[model samples]
Target chain A: MDKPKKSALIQKDGVSISEITNKNSIENLKNKRKSEMDPNELVDSILNKDITALSRAITLIESKNPKHLKAANTILKGCLPHANKSVRIGITGIPGVGKSSFIETFGNHLTKLGKRVAVLAIDPSSSVSRGSILGDKTRMEDLVKNDNAYIRPSASGDSLGGVARKTRETITLCEAAGFNIIIIETVGVGQSETTVHSMVDFFLLLKLAGAGDELQGIKRGIIEMADLIAINKADGDNLKAAKLAKTEFTRALHLYPKKSSNWNPKVTVCSATENTGIDKIWSMVLDYVEITTKNAYFIKKRNEQNKYWLLQTIETQLKFYFFNQPKIKKELKNQLQLIENNKTTPFAAADYLLNL
Target chain B: MDKPKKSALIQKDGVSISEITNKNSIENLKNKRKSEMDPNELVDSILNKDITALSRAITLIESKNPKHLKAANTILKGCLPHANKSVRIGITGIPGVGKSSFIETFGNHLTKLGKRVAVLAIDPSSSVSRGSILGDKTRMEDLVKNDNAYIRPSASGDSLGGVARKTRETITLCEAAGFNIIIIETVGVGQSETTVHSMVDFFLLLKLAGAGDELQGIKRGIIEMADLIAINKADGDNLKAAKLAKTEFTRALHLYPKKSSNWNPKVTVCSATENTGIDKIWSMVLDYVEITTKNAYFIKKRNEQNKYWLLQTIETQLKFYFFNQPKIKKELKNQLQLIENNKTTPFAAADYLLNL
Candidate 1:
């Protein structure tokens, strides 16, 4: 395919040229085998801001094979030195809250400011749904077509912890590829919002106006985790109601004790469909970064999060190690049944399992 | 000391006759020695509503010696058949929120209604302070004098897990002793609130009226966890402000999505000092129990909490086992330092530790 025609055809489907290259590279990877591969070669490409290499590294990280995981870890170690440069933000909202349009407008706004934006997502529901949610490029059409932006959906068919670790490493790869603004998006369903929130500097909760006191299906825990809440669709007939919702949320936010970071959560009104108040949200994020950095909370929070993930990773692995053993699994099931019957205390059962 | 004077003298300190009897029994136990005593004899005494034996069993559970642990476990297994009969309530507030006075008043109210009451506390701070907080019976004078009431402070000098397990076991012992209503008190300073909340049927958050915007230092997370929030010290000069605080909290609670229990959290005003609204708070708790039992959430939530605690106990043990190993601890310390230096990703450090 000719370059312009290929670009036009791919744009019709909202798939980026980089995504297409990633697909071709996967095919090339199998045929090329192990002969011509150098891990550092890919690392150098990624550090040199090569989008194709970054996407390929992410694909490897998402792979379930042990060999791929080894390669992924090696590349991740290489990329670590180049990471933490981007302002990572997490965006989440219930369905029908205009998350896709908001992300597109926000990405475009960032690109217009001469910042490269990379969008990623964490949807562990792909296995149950048999398809990824954000994986559909047709949703974020404008940003997909923007040469200055790159978007990838959730890595499917793995445990939630597996995907979270993969996404965390993918952030490093994107940062190495020179994406100055990285957006991690999650649907406000299940625990994905928490996963995304832990990995981001700023967490934005998008809400719709006039849910009529039901919180529009947003989980209370998610709202509590938000650093900022934007009432979306604040234009045309919805403008007044959105403004009212903003005030209501502001009052609700006041009930919370001040955060340890000393950053009070802000509520604002926005209409992503009309591209209104998009810059204001970005500025809010910038303000958060500046203030937190000044107070040293930015670095402190990141280090703490790093330590948390370290302990979390170890716990997950240890659980996997014990759980995967046939003898332990059989014993665990019996002990669990006893616990269900109230025949054994949990501590006693744990002691039994440890002995086993 | 004769029985009546000993009881009256201990009552002045708010210590129950049962506590005094338990102290005497400990001396008798030393003279009798282990070989002459049967664990089932104590279990039978507990089952027969012998408060002294119940307190002694709890002391055994809280002991660190393996021999005592074995005896405690034996008594717990015997008592398990008679447990789960009581309504467990958790009450928390920052210091000076009058938790002790509220519980005393509430306990007296329950006992007046001819219900057996047990008050326990999970003060993890006792060790740090080198003195127990709620362990001071002088604070709960009225309930300590009530023949139908039993109170115990947190078991000091153990890990939080050890304390939680002991408290949970103590609940069984209390229920076996025919105490039908259990109140667990925790200072809202740390994670003890969550631990207490998890084991209780209802969680009540106590706040003060005139703390201005501080919410009496109760955490937003704790408020969110509450089934009921009571503004204490709502008497005389604080009455109007307490009512206003009640309105503010009701509005704040409205912003959160309805809890899965289908029960909306309530905010009420009460004065522990004046002993007003004590009956109302007990009525609210009873109402919660009635509704949840009718809807079957009462049983369902208990089952879920049981399963949750089981998993939590296992995880805590696994972490302890791995972290306690001398070689792993040394290696983990080095890897953590590297993570702090940003020279290693958490996942990478986790992998190294797992390999070790």
Candidate 2:
């Protein structure tokens, strides 16, 4: 078969393919220009509260270039002391639950209180396609150009571990740049929420009221991990329904075992668009931080999380190294075959590999 | 700081410690004599339904003796075909929830229908000191004396992994002995319930009515894993409370995401002491099996479990070997110190170790 004409093949809605290609190329060049900076200079500029330098450092951390590894580490080390001074919060909800609007409203509220707010996202799927819904700046129209708010889209990468690592490092950079409140937003998808939950001090789960189908798709484990659940879009027609949902969620929360942190998980109603009940949620977060800090659980939990990340990183790297080795990979295949055939026990195979 | 006399130091209650020690020695000698048979002899004897031989085979599997390793593997291979024909069930509940009585009633119900039943326990805490409450066979008086029922206490081992492995192997031996029903019981104190749930075809959680304190201790993860939750000891004064609890639980379960297995978790009330609802519970199990078998989920789940255990066993053994090495252990301690001091990133430490 003869190939179709290049113009006809790539044409969509009568626009030429080269026009789209050139536009994307120009955007890529602009991003490339924005990220060009030495590690030491980047750190100095970020500490001086230069947002451009902070953004460049985050891009450096997310880069896969082998040369960027050392630079990323250097910038991260310089930012460590300034980090952890902020109250980091994780916000999550399924798609169509108004996560972007909620963040925009909540972030605007924080900025109104003279707080510098930084919003980051942990979306693993974006790593694959680089076309994440949140990648569009227009999604959060109100907060896009706010001087006190910094909204960064999810970093693009191939693996969740890589994305998570970059996001964690970016948090420190944001903190060092004088951001007092860092809000890590993630869509309630797979393991991304859990990853965000671990890195944040307070985890807020957003939900829409009067959606029975919503309850059936939300895992109980996620609900149990939530520190606060807000019934969102609680305005006009959704007012009574949101109140009813709030009561139902409160009863459900009562059944969960009390958290070791001794903080009760709360459920409240909110209207992000209308900006109702936003202050109550902020006060709830403040109350939690005050109580947990007074009891020393705040420091204890952060210390434990730090240790956990260390062990987790080591475990993941060790497995990756082991499986990536040519000899070990071949042996692993053989061992799995043996296990499938029940010719040798899993323990015996593992023993043989360890000895080798 | 002088020590007391040896006899007085070890004495408990009114009995001298030496007398108890001598009695235990005699019992050990008897058990040693019983387990001295060869691998082939033990397999033949177990296949012939000799309870003593079956017990000895299980002991061989649980033994740390190097000599028992080959024999255990040989016996397990011989029994592989006989396993997978039985329906394995997992039962769990917090202490004081009448787990013993519930199992006794349920076991009797199956045996009365001409099915031989095998009961095993996975108590990691018992392995630490062998003083677990389930270590007492006297607690299950009814099942202990029943000819068609075999009750085995938790295997005494140092870790949950060791106990889980032994219990899994014991299931095969019981199947070879022609027991068509196998019930693995665990306490819902920690991760043991999850381990047992992974190995069983059906998981049942026991609870007492009118005990809000009970709900406060039971983790939501455990409830989410339960195929059925039974409100036990629901008789006379507790009947109304049990009914109310059942309604509450059912409502709570409705909010959870439906399981991929397409089975909705069921909540019911029962009186193990009065032997009420025993048949109904058995019927529920039968119904589950019937439906899952027709949909091929029964075999699919078991096959998936088999593969899961194989991978899990390998992963556990690999970690154990890596951590137990003197060189690795020393280096790990040093790396952990560096992590605590914030002198090294987790990825950097892990990379160094992997290269080593």
Candidate 3:
């Protein structure tokens, strides 16, 4: 409850907050959160379905501040026992494919079915520049305004993938808070698709009718990972084109062997604007769950993904830390400049940096 | 020089018997204009313009054995002073695009122009399965039969790109042996393509006609790196298609902003089988050298590539050595298994192994 008392207690438990906090401002934020209650108490509040505590817990988990990591780790431990209850779905699509519109329509449909839907949408417009693209919550006002749905725009930080990691931890936090269904609508298409795919149970790839060869231009690796490919915007004149695209997609999809071994990828047509075929998509997703769960592949896959995320996280952090080392930073920059000047090369610069 | 004296002198210089033996074999095979001598003495005898010593030096450089590496390195140091004065040309295409046919026509044309040409090709074949797709030298019997042209297939032990590295080092040896042009051929589609690209002064991408929209499927990154995209197999009815592909390729090349400051990728049509446009292609390559050389970008890029190869070599060797440390190998394998089975992550496994 008190600052020094809590600090002492935290220190006694071998988490002195030194490894988690560096700057005064971050420490103040952590201390403020600590003053409100014990770290375990906040976690307990989250378990009671307190959305505010759940959100705060996620922020703690995501913080770069040294002191927060220890607290966040403990919070994660507390939340783990209460997590993994909800169905998690990942939605990815290229730009201008109406991803926001689809998520809003689909979120409304879920709420209408008497399910509490939480949308962990990662769209950081300010951080990542976009042109001719929809990348904000304003585009999904209907869903954001809904009582049963919670939509959070991406928080600014490192990679969109890093943002996705926080969103994933938040998904667990939300799941522990008894959210029935979690939808992680990626920023768009391939960039965040792989990151989002590593954490969710079902992956949905959205496409417009006229994608044509552009689909191949986008990564084949992501397309191969997709569980379902939905030709979005299947309303009006687009319907004919959507059906044609669906056939083309079916042809392309045949090239990839069945991904899940026990499950076959499905191709579907939907009009997100009209909110038609949303229920069918949900039903199909549940069918996947049914099959994968029966084969015990669901947990096995999630565990694999968790390990992948952990490795990716550590690799990224170590690389960042290694590059930022005082002894390496300036010399590394110099070597990079040498490479840019064609005096050395990217491989040589990497070697020099790592060896140093 | 007798065997015992030569052996004593070579041993004193810290050179292995195998290095001397490999070089001696090449000496014995040489159709000399002058006198016959002991193969061991022949290597030291032809210090001025010895194609045989050059061949043996390349053989040592290509060997995977540690002793071979040391001996090759020493030989390379010795050859460096008299290394290649030739322009290195790397040609890549997918399988069945007539690489051999193209090289045969091109090399013969060079030999007719009174230039001694060397055709060093890398075929992705294994020694265990020794038969090469283009094993029969009769495919290029014209070039092979030419006294002015030397043809060597990829050696049996290593990867294609590896064969290229060996060939590159050998190119220096060949140039010293008075071969003015070195052509390294591979499919533009494999990992070998990029590897070959880094080692050569010019990278030529050969494409087939009627590639159509399939051309779009080729990776933009790889395409952007090409200095020339030749619409090969441009004979017969395919001529119209080839011309069309050339136009399309030119258009695609325009879409890419100028790369490497000076190089603007050129699009041309050629038929390796018809022997048409082959000479023109060579002239275009000469023009490229003329332009890039006047601008000094040629040798600059080569210097950068040298640094890259050095760094790449070091990094790979470091990774191999670190992972193979006798005490840590078992633990590393165990951790890798745990990572594969989802018990831990690759990052953690790496960290654990490093600590161990």
Candidate 4:
């Protein structure tokens, strides 16, 4: 049969409709395949600063499937050489302390300085709450739209250790993707702050100004972990309270022992809404890097952190293997009962289980 | 022939000299055997409140020999039923904070109140320092001489976990031996305070008045763990400073979040030298017990602590087994080198080692 003549309304273009659709589908298929790229190709794409490749690599790292884990490890090994080049800053605060706003403002500031920034969250509670702190990109609208910024919500896992490992591996992928500054965000309510603190070069604690009670709601060990405490919402009516809180924190920080970094913890007032004090915070980070790097503590601390993560990962996996064993699952309940009955001490029970 | 050579001055009233000498030697041998009693015999003696048997049992628990470990486990199982009966109080202070004197005074006070007091130390540094904090019985001369008090020096061990286990086991033996009060002493420095804090019903931090610097030299988490902070050496000229410190600490303690036990940590000035305020400290402990028990937090906390120790022991053992393997020992070194050379991520290295 002869082909139907083209209607006057359907003006002929240089390319035929069939050719155009075929070419479009082929390109779409190529992109789909690239999303599921081999480990080496993913690494190559990540190294060439491909954010999609980095995200896919992180998905592989976060996968529960054993096959995906194997691929993730291969990609991780490829990325390791390029990792450790970025400065990882841990940011934490209570739920309403403007974490997202602070991150948005700070991340934009970082990008403006000709830097690539990656923001990762570690809210292990997200699994239970089903509402991750960073799950909504609308919270950081401007930074989300920035080409130099990448944001990943908290990865849900059965335990903080599992989530920590996924986030840690994602950091390596982001670093390989040429992100020079990585911000690890966590809520201050749980042990997530500690996990983030262990992985970061500098830890920033965001605080809200309370009525003359600066340290009232601060969690223990958090201030000690913080390299900087930024009292947010220091605009309009809250500015005075934030300044007072900064003074109180400064006085409180002096009570802590001299940090091994030989750098004093600094307290500052910031207004994420007004986008004020963000530059000073970045300058402080630069100052910290300059001092720590000059004294060799930066490299030393990174090395120690690497060793910490190595041992921590091993210990976590060891526990996972032990507690998940079917024999242990059954015997542990029996042992706990024995403990409750006062028939066996925890030490003795531990011995019995270890023997088993 | 020697019996025949006895002069009139050596004449026996009702027995021969040879018989008396034989009787004395037999008694000495029996006492020696008691010191080296078997596990069952040790358990019997400990139940009867025999101090020597308790000492021997603790020695076995501290020994590095596998045979001793077996004996210790047997003794631990025997004593397990009787453990958790005593009020275990953990005392910690810096080197010059008068921990020894304070413990001596507090122990004597406890004994005077008709409470059988057992003192155990957990100074892991003693292994290297060759100077355990409680090594010299002369430090607590009055308490050592008191029939109602027992003092044992810290058990030297290669690791804090080893020392902690030994001390924990010793506490069981002490409780089994009918001691109603157990005091665990550790230096304020390092992780020993945390170890001691974990294994006690109450944690007391001893401090000195440091020229208006109330919190100076205080470790980060120590204050948070403390159920009470005693300003020691509050006599003569130091009395005013001690009171000042008490006020500052009271204010500082207010900054911490409410403890899980729902008890406010108290601060007081005490003179270990003058023996004043000792009774008040004991009264405070009783008050703590009354409140926590009323709320059932006392038993609840102990149960949680038991679970903590159980999991901690298992984790420590797991790491020990994994790290001590000849294959792991060698591969770990290789993996560390790979980490240093940026050839592997910590998670990947952990996976490799875990698979092996």
Residue A327 in candidate 2, Cα distance off native in Å: 4.9
Regions more than 4 Å wrong, model 4 = A1-44, A65-67, A95-97, A207-216, A229-276, A290-296, A340-342, B1-37, B95-97, B207-216, B229-270, B291-296
Off by over 4 Å in 1: A1-39, A127-133, A207-270, A274-276, A287-296, A336-343, B1-41, B65-67, B92-102, B124-133, B157-159, B187-190, B202-303, B337-344
Candidate 3 structure quality by residue, lDDT tens digits, B126-204: 3336545445677897887777787666666544545545666666656656777888876444466677777788878
lDDT of 4 at A7: 71
lDDT for each residue of candidate 2 in B68-164, tens digit (9 for 90 to 100) = 9999989987877666679999999988899998988999889999999999998858778775656787778788878799998888778887788
Rank by DockQ, descending? 4, 1, 2, 3
**Of candidates 4 and 1, the better by lDDT:** 4
Query: Chain A TM-scores, one per candidate?
Result: 0.88, 0.89, 0.78, 0.88
lDDT of 2 by residue, A85-160 (tens): 7899999888889889999999999999999999999886887877565687678887877888988998877777
Positional deviation of B105 in candidate 4, in angstroms?
A: 3.0
Off by over 4 Å in 2: A1-36, A124-133, A156-158, A207-224, A229-269, A287-296, A325-342, B1-30, B34-36, B65-70, B127-133, B207-220, B229-270, B290-295, B324-342
Comparing 1 and 3 by DockQ, which wins?
Answer: 1
Better of 1 and 2 by lDDT: 1
lDDT tens per residue, model 4, B88-116: 99998877888888988999989888999
Query: Model 4 chain A, poorest ten-residue lDDT window?
Result: A211-220
DockQ, every prediction: 0.35, 0.25, 0.11, 0.40
Q: Per-model C-alpha lDDT, please?
A: 0.84, 0.82, 0.70, 0.87
For every candidate, C-alpha RMSD to the true structure in Å: 7.2, 7.7, 12.6, 9.4
What DockQ does candidate 3 have relative to the true complex?
Answer: 0.11
Docking class of 2: acceptable
Ordered from best to worst lDDT, the candidate numbers read 4, 1, 2, 3
